[model samples]
Target: MGVSGGSPTSRFECTRRLSAADSQCIWNAIAEIGARVGDRFTSNVPLFNCFGDHKMAVRGLVSARPWVADDGQEGGGGDGGIMMVAGYPSLREAVIAVAKKELREDRVSREQALQLMKEWLQKSQDIKNGRLDDAFILRFLRVKKFSVPLAQQTILKYLHFRNIYSHYCRQLDYLEPPVYELLKSGYLFALPQRDKLGRRVIFANAGKLDPYKYHNTDMAKAHLVTYETLLEDEDNQVLGFNHVTDLKGVCAAQMTLWSPSELGAIIKLGEQAVPMRHKEIHFLNVPPAFRMVYDFCKTLFSEKMRNRFYLHSSLEELHQSVDPKILPKEYGGTIPMSEMIDMWMKEVSRKRDALLSLDRMESQKVMHSYKPRTTTPKASNGITSLPGSFRRLEVD
Candidate 1:
């Protein structure tokens, strides 16, 4: 078990801070949950999570809706699920295989990789003591398709970005006026339930945003903060995530905030730096008035990015792809949208100090030493060799 590093007060953080024995207990609990999920290693492993007073309802993989639970509800969901389907290998086997592959590619065992990264990461002396974990290392590897050198490079760049970015690398004070304004505007939500296919959903309720007060820059930072928190879930690293953005009230009035430079910067961050792999983006309720804005924004998107853009005219159409059960309460689901909003606010509040700490770390000089390879590396994703149906994954 590893201490979670991205968000403040994350259960991953809480569990990570636990003494070795307690952290082992959490792993024991995980094994127990996996056992109860089904017969052997193929069963679904569920890890229930809590955010402040909220109990995130989760299944298949670890995903939490940052909100207080509905009245009287305990913090868990049914585990009669399966992680391995059809004729695939067990979950444990999958992880082992990936680890082996990474070792073979990098010419180092898991322990060696961890030690190497620690040496590089500790050079800045700005990170928390013993914050690096196997899962953290695995994410970098997974994102870079198991290329050790590439993953190492991404790790450095991520730290470098935080060191330089004004709002990130610990300089982010959630209590700041800009942060407060972003929270009050309600630009994002991580739904309480995974989609029918088990992918986590991130809802960008652009309609709920007050265009005059909503800064696109803040929106991008909000995404980083959210990813930092949610990516703490180890299983989510494998299960992946999808996004649904509603551009309902977007108009020329709001377009004033859409700076091309700001959009491009975020696009690069999402594609090259962020560790999570997104499944898709469903842009529902896109207003006709927002067409000009979308057109300009589309230019920043590449063929890969544009291909995932889904524009649905109505809620029914959107639900065709996304299960309504995991959608916001206003969108015909059991989830409480207000609670999700409240959770996001609390998350921001808790992470402010840690974020600010990273902001001041200044890794510009350190990055030069660990710069990633110019030669891109992408390994075989789980199903490339398999037959038939597939899940469409994208970087949001």
Candidate 2:
């Protein structure tokens, strides 16, 4: 998963002043949590995330209420005192736009494209190892371009369905048939019925149930008669036979059938190994956010630069160096400070070592177990067979 975001931690300092020790404690807590979560899902998948303007939003640093610009412009407030314009789109839209732009440029060769996808798969292996640097990501955004493919669009549709399934219907059991029918043929099945209150009610008959009930209705009246009449006069037929003989064995006096165990043995031996190299890549990319947090902490403690100067300068530099191509309005990172911090902390806690150990245990249960093949033989075609003699191989 290719994650792109701000410097893993808020750029804004806490409003309530903290002593050096307090600051260090908070930083340590953040680091620990980040490390834990990053390790947990590092081998899972790539999550190509892009940062938004509100990257500096952290609890005790920003307000819960949406920030309003001093200029009275709505939706323009952000961390580091940056004010957005009214026309700016949300972060999701921005990321989508960037992805589209990347697709449009067509910079990557077919081979390179495959390689890049492989890298994403590899990055899903471990969070800490898989984490990307902000500068590196910025460079990648500058050079690499992409478009949201049809597969991603399909995924988005599924995600949207999952999000709003409750609002549109009682449960998913009733929704899939109609949705699939609509997607496939543009026409939907409708059951013409009436409620007790005399209100006309229409339910999807996408299950193809009770075709006769729809025969006289307006929906079926147009073509049902023609179809039924045509089917009745159809040339469909069936053949009957008492027994069958195998022509291939006609010359042979006897034949031997393969055992189920033998077939299973052959299949098992022919199976290819599951691709695990990609898991390594995933492991490498997983902990990028935590690494960012760690690096940010290190920057705060640099001996060459005063901590105060480093903090102010780093924030200002990032603010001024925003690339127009990868702008927040085109990608992500616009989460409010408080919400961002809350989400990070929650993710950290949710993916702790204890939870991950349980996950690992569960995964082991579903993994296929390999059993060695035995040389045992069984009777075939009601004939007991010898190990290797020609007399043992017989056909009826």
How well is each residue in 1-396 modelled by candidate 2, as lDDT tens digits?
A: 112223223323432355556545543443344344431112122221111222223222222223222333222211111122122222222233433443342225433544554465244332123223222222222222322243222222322322222122122121134332231221221111111111111111122322222211222221121111111210100000011011221211111222334333322321111000000000111122233322433343224222222121232243332222222221123433333223222322332332223112111111234343233223333443323332243323
What's the distance in Å from true for residue 361, model 1? 4.0
Residues 1-396, model 1: lDDT tens digits: 111123433544444445666445444454465445322322222234422222211221132112122221222121112234122233334434443553343335545666667676676454444245565677776666666688777776676565445444343555666656665566775664555544557788676655456555455566676676556554456556788988766544344343345456656655676777676888887666555456667667667777877878999998898878667788878757786566556544544544554444344444333222232122224322112221122112
Pick by TM-score: which candidate is best? Answer: 1
Model 1 lDDT at residue 36: 55
What is candidate 2's TM-score against the reference? 0.17
Candidate 2, residue 377: Cα displacement in angstroms equals 60
What would you estimate as the lDDT of candidate 2?
A: 0.25
Q: Which ten residues in a row have the lowest lDDT in candidate 1?
A: 71-80
User: Can you tell me which runs of candidate 2 are displaced by over 4 Å?
Assistant: 1-87, 104-319, 322-343, 351-396
381, model 2: CA deviation in Å? 82
Listed per candidate, the RMSD to the true structure in angstroms reads 14.2, 29.5
